[model samples]
Target: MNELERSVLAKIDQEQLARLCRQLIQAPSENPGGNEESTVLLLQSLLQDLGSTVHLQYAAPGRPNLIAHLGGGNAGGGLLFLGHSDVVPAGSGWDADPFTARREGNRLIGRGATDMKGGLSAVIAAMASVNQHAPHIPLTLICTVDEEANALGIEHYISTAEAAQYLACIVAEPTDLITIIGCRAAANLQVQISGASAHAGRPSDGASAIEAAAELVALIGENKQKLAAAPHPVLGPATWNVGTLKAGHGTSIVPDEAWLGIDRRLLPGEDPQQVLDALLAAARNRIEAAENLDALKLQIRGSVQMFMPGFLTDPEAPLVRQVCTTLQDLGAAGKHGIWTASCEGGFIAEHHNVPTVVLGPGEINTQAHQPNESVSVSDLHTAACAYALIALRQYETSQN
Candidate 1:
């Protein structure tokens, strides 16, 4: 690595790093109405102070995306570090206030602590360090809103002309410090069942949509193993899940409508449409055969809509090799492979055609999205150092 790169790695400030992570958790950009205005502004102010040019764009009225840039001397293609500012709502079950960004000993506890304001903070801290040393790599930091709800902000950014130039990208999601070369695609789907409603006394004259929904769910459950068996060279198997179900308003009346929400994990070659068709076919068969069915019909509703597709990068790809070398330089073991879960890897690789990977602190088994969510302070410092080293490697490769 060059002198500038070495300097950048050495300048990381641990206190400021932890502060950024905590502040983001405290901001409460929860998915229900995901407000990232304050969070974006915080990053914008910091980036501007570090002599980087920044821009804020919106997907919806209030939500914003912050992009900060630092140019290299000879830029063929720059590297982009992307992550989201929004987090899922912390519903009732917490021992500590989920939005308070509480710190107990070495762990930082909050809604976004591990899923991942911690990842975002690590990258930002690395950026601050790189800025002080005058970076040799052309770097861009993209912080967008709505990742927890939908990816509207990132989808909007990807559709733009100016965002297409990057050669590679990284999404700083929690990964137990492993290098994620690929991720399965998380495709959101909805199934609706409709039937005629009647009073409890006259149940024979009416159809129960709730019953049809139950039958449909049964059909899906039976086929779960089949769906899970689809093979991918890298991603291994696709997974299916029914996340939510709702039917009926009261006990006296038969439900006329029922809704079911599903999360399908796509392997590299699996088509979302095919998955939907298979589900629809199963529902149609089950609905037509069920007892007490006056009339049964199933239809697919709106989906996640922004699926870019699953992706994998060759271990020998230039960017991958560069990152590996950098990690080795930083005293890491330097292994790489595909992760079973989904992340923005699909977006960066499929939408932008950029070589993308997810590498960060924290362990994959550490109960993210569960109560007592937290990240290790030791991992935090280590991840910052790793990101700094990776940034330097990209610059070194570009020069050669």
Candidate 2:
């Protein structure tokens, strides 16, 4: 490590880092209502204190995003650190208060602590550390809202011209300190089945929409098996989930309407539209082939409510290499991997063509979206160092 890198690493204050993580977790920026204004203001103040220029942009009335820039004067390209501020709802089964930010030994426990608040705090601390050394490398930090819900904050940011100028992006998602080069795409599918309604006593007079919906659901399950046959080398197979099913109002009446909600995960090369079309066609064919259902006059409609394309960044890319090398220099094993869950990295990579990687602290399987979410304090410290070192190295490379 060079003098600047050493200085930046030394500037990381563990207490301050812990305090920031606690404060953010306590803010309760849950996505259902998307109350991120408080979190945005907190980040704005933190960035300002680090001597960085902070901009607050709103995608909606109560939903805001924070963009902080430092040291862009002499650099031709800058590194962007992207993180989300919103967290999934903290459900029951917590041993302690989900928002209390309890610390036991090396672990800090709370909602959003591992999912991303801890990562976000690490990024903020790293930015502050790098700012102290007065390095010439340009850096941008983006803390977006609604990542747990619709990801509107990032969706809005990437639509602007500023998002296209980044040399690379590091999304601080929970990755257990490994480098994630790709992630699967995701889409929400809604299937509506329509049929005639009648009294429960007259079975032959009315068609049961519930029965037709069940048949369609069975067809979807069969299609899922076909999708699993072809899997991406890194991302694994495309998957489908029937998340929700609703039909019929009462036990006495034959239901006229039914709905099925599905979550479809697409592989890197698969087209989302094609997948939807194929599923619809399968349902249509199955319904037409059914001998008894012809008299029921059943109809099925499929629509995609949301779509996020999958992406893969070459492991040999300059930014990816720098990140891996920096992690190794920081005394951590650097390995390239893929994330099964969806993240903003996919959107950034597909829409802006920016090479993006997911690298941060905490284990996603054990900590993310769980009742008592927590992150290792040691992991947080290492993440701070890694982020700082990567920024410094990227700056040096740009200068050469």
Best by lDDT: 2
Off by over 4 Å in 1: 1-5, 73-77, 296-308
RMSD list, candidates in order? 2.5, 1.9
Write out the backbone clash pairs for model 2: none
TM-score of each: 0.91, 0.95
lDDT of 1 by residue, 1-400 (tens): 6677667766776777788888888877778776778778877777787667888888889898877886564342476788888877787779988988888888888888888788888987887786567555677888878877667887888777354677578788888776788878878887777777789888776678788878777877777777566577677777778889898978999778888888888876678878787778767766676665654333333345445456788878887777666667767777787787677667667766788888876665554677778888767877887777676666666667
- The weakest ten consecutive residues by lDDT in model 2 span 70-79
Off by over 4 Å in 2: 73-77, 161-163, 294-296
| Residues 1-400 of candidate 2: C-alpha lDDT, one tens digit per residue | 7787888899998878988899989888877878888778888888787678888889889888888887765233477888988988888999988988889988899998998989999999987788778656678888888888766887787776354567778899999999998888998888888888888898567777888877788987887788788888778898999999999989999888899888999876677778778887887787778765653477878788777777788889888888888888878898788888888787777665778899988999988998889999888999998998888877677679
In terms of TM-score, how similar is model 1 to the real structure?
0.91
